[model samples]
Target: MRTLTVFALMAVVLGGSGRAAEVVVPADMSCRTEGFGYADTNRHDSSKLSVRASSNGNKSWIKFDQLGDYDLSKLRAATLTVFLHEGKSGSQQCDVSAVNDDVTENIKWVDHPNQENPAEEIYALTWNNAPGNLTSDMGLLDAAKTTYIDTITFTDGVEGQGFEVEVLDILLADTDGIVQFVLHNSPNLLNFATHDNPTEAKQPYLTLRFAPEGADHPVPEDGAEVDTTLAQLAWTNPEPNTPGEPIYCDVYLGADPNRLLMDKVEVGPDVSGVAINTDNFPNFGLLANKVTYYWVVDCYDTDKGLIKGEFWSFYTNDNLPPEVDAGADQVVWLGMGEDPNQVTTTLSGVTSDDGLPGPYTVLWTQEVNDAPAVVIVNADQDVATVTFSERGVYEFTLTADDGDKQTSDTVQVIVGDSPCDASHMSTGEPYHPADANQDCIVDLADFVLLLAEDWLACTDTLTQCGMLLPM
Candidate 1:
């Protein structure tokens, strides 16, 4: 990413907040666990109250119930930057609101979006701001754009309720796994809160609040573990950097990086060490071609509100596959070891070059003379299984297809004897009538055997032969 000038930032923030003394809503909220990434556009069932990132995606916006718990005087105006992982396609919108904790009418809802959402609103940033939450878009900057810095404030309402705005929401979605976020504050306020708190996952995040123009927004000093050149930026804050109010962080990302050639990039943990799952970061689907670039980011820390970090770069060998026996066996069992008795057998060892996830197929064979079975085709998951069944050898063939070609491997196993014996009946002896081994029936064969075997007493036990009732 290039650099951004400070002047361009303030205008974007002011333009979005609307009138300084805008009529806000009653909003107060406690902590609520939420599902993130891809949110839904549909309203909440309980008045669209329970809001989390749905398939609707990273599009940012806050939704909650509102009533009297909020005093507009207690609410201050602020500016927030919504950042997303560059090269990633999704929504990053601002959310703000005031929800009354009241039951029936509204409950468990609280928040305000930076900007209102339009129906046809195809947003690069789903900006929403309400009585409580504040949102801003530094707007979109080209990869060649320079670093941007800014100061914030609201014009009307009450002259000095001590309102503030720093960086707020900081989120980046990437086909590439990294995101960079930055926050700015007034020089008078020595202390400041980070716009957003740390998020889950290993994606890089850093947050900082500079003292009165603190450090020209530290640029990536070059030669680091991440590429500063490929990262996007955003933030959130109260009208000014105030003390003990709400300085929730909100970040975002857009399509802009240095030189602007990035389509998508694979990103996750260092990923150089994970071995158990076969494919690295399989769930996120973020991995890319081998390359090097720089990145910068910020995060909300327990101690430091938002501490900013410098840009760094790291190189990746994205083309290598997991280290497994390609020529050897391709199956692994669950509980059953060398021999499995009604356990599971999974096909393994089919992977790819760039390590994107997979282009693997799960095939099965019973080893009974029948042709192999096609279980799953083009599955991103590596292993395929043949669950518990009758005792015998089960074979699985894993075929890996990478676009233009296919690679295959097989694994087989033997099932042990049945858990229950079929030949014996409830009695301690083998299953039979009065004449054991008489070919299993009381026909002529058994009659002859009965005559040879026993004699006289009449008893319920078949073993005792009584005065014969003519068969």
Candidate 2:
């Protein structure tokens, strides 16, 4: 188990001097456990978060989503700040621990009184009645052990006291893009403002500080047009990661600027280039032929600090030809029943384009394979009709033109004198339409079987007497 030591805890004023890269993210979800009025009821919408012990214990949990926005690898300090709405504590100690799962807002005290059943005691903070400052180091359990940093002292019991605790180790070890903490005080009753607090500024939040920044000049440049096959991305890192000081670069790429959840690439120290291919973009797929791609880079230096890069965009070339599918290879017979040689089949072709240079054109032409030549109506359209003059095999080609490029596909059409002539065989393999008995032959035996199976199976309501009316 990896453990993180809580180095310090201070009961400082809420407002303080801010850092350049400091980010204050409020808890998006929060809930408190009620043990007195309703132990099983969820207080997610409650404006106050209460923590107490005794028999009617009350605990609170706060959760923050999208932790990926901050670089945890280069996190220098993470302070959990909460506004004490109503509470007076002289020597009471409150502890905060990490939970295994992201607890929903509908959490109840009856679910787990002590903490969430799966909650892990990652870290805790203790404060005494002594004035000034105190240095208290405590260990918290996780995958590893814990260590303490500073001490927190609560002199006179008073309302509206803001508490700040360092929780760097907890945030650093989080794998999922979520940060959740549970607050518990066994002896003292304390109430804090929650995310639903009337005053938004008094709500609980986390302030994060990351490493320094770095200058990056991306290859191919931003907004440059490049080939579709370009697979590598290079950058000039003014401060490269050395052997002792490792750095990671997270690359986010997508067409939509809002949903750029691309993969992150961890580059070794001294390396300044990374490959941009399908292996990195599992959800985004491959680079399209003609598209304007947007990408951002965030680097985390183990020594100097972490810095996020600006958004860069480049357009891919669009000279590729259109794709086409000439439907499935068709199998048609001469004619149904009465007409044995007047077969007219419609040919449907599908085409796809990138809309690059402009619009495209489509045409369907007959290929001379085995035939006495066929007549095609509307040969310049994707859907055309072809009439067969003789019984043989034929092919129709559908070609698409985009002014600069042309692509074509062909479909085969087989025509015969009768249903048996075009498809029947002695091998009993290929489908034969006239083979009613399924013997692969169109003989008198098939007709006898058909009559015996469907002798008087007609669904005509008006002809109950079995007399047919002329239409």
For residues 1-471, could you state the per-residue lDDT of candidate 2 as single tens digits?
222222222323233211225677787766666454454454454567776665566666677776877778877778787766665646655666655433322222221223444354321111111011011211122322222323334544344466677888878877766776666643667677787678666677887876435535678687898877777777755464455566667667777654345555566555677677767766554778678887766676676566667667788875778898999876666674346658788888888888758988888888876467777788887788887757777888999898877999999887766666666422235656667766557888877876777777777878755886766
Clashes of each: 114, 25
**CA shift of 331, model 1, Å:** 21
What lDDT tens digits, residue by residue, belong to model 1 across residues 1-471?
A: 112112111122121121123232211222221222212122221111222233222212222223123232223322332222121123222222222112122112232232334444322221231111122222221222212323233222121112222322211111121122222221111111112213211111122221211111222233323222323322122232344433223121112333133232222211111121214213212423344543333333333455332333444333333332223442222335544444554555445444434543333333444423434332345654555545434555555554434556555544434322312221235545564443444566666666645555356555345544545
* Cα lDDT computed for each candidate against the true fold: 0.29, 0.63
My TM-score estimates for the predictions, one after another, are 0.19, 0.34
- Name the best candidate (by lDDT): 2
Maximum-TM-score candidate: 2
Give the C-alpha miss distance for residue 469 in model 1, angstroms.
Answer: 26
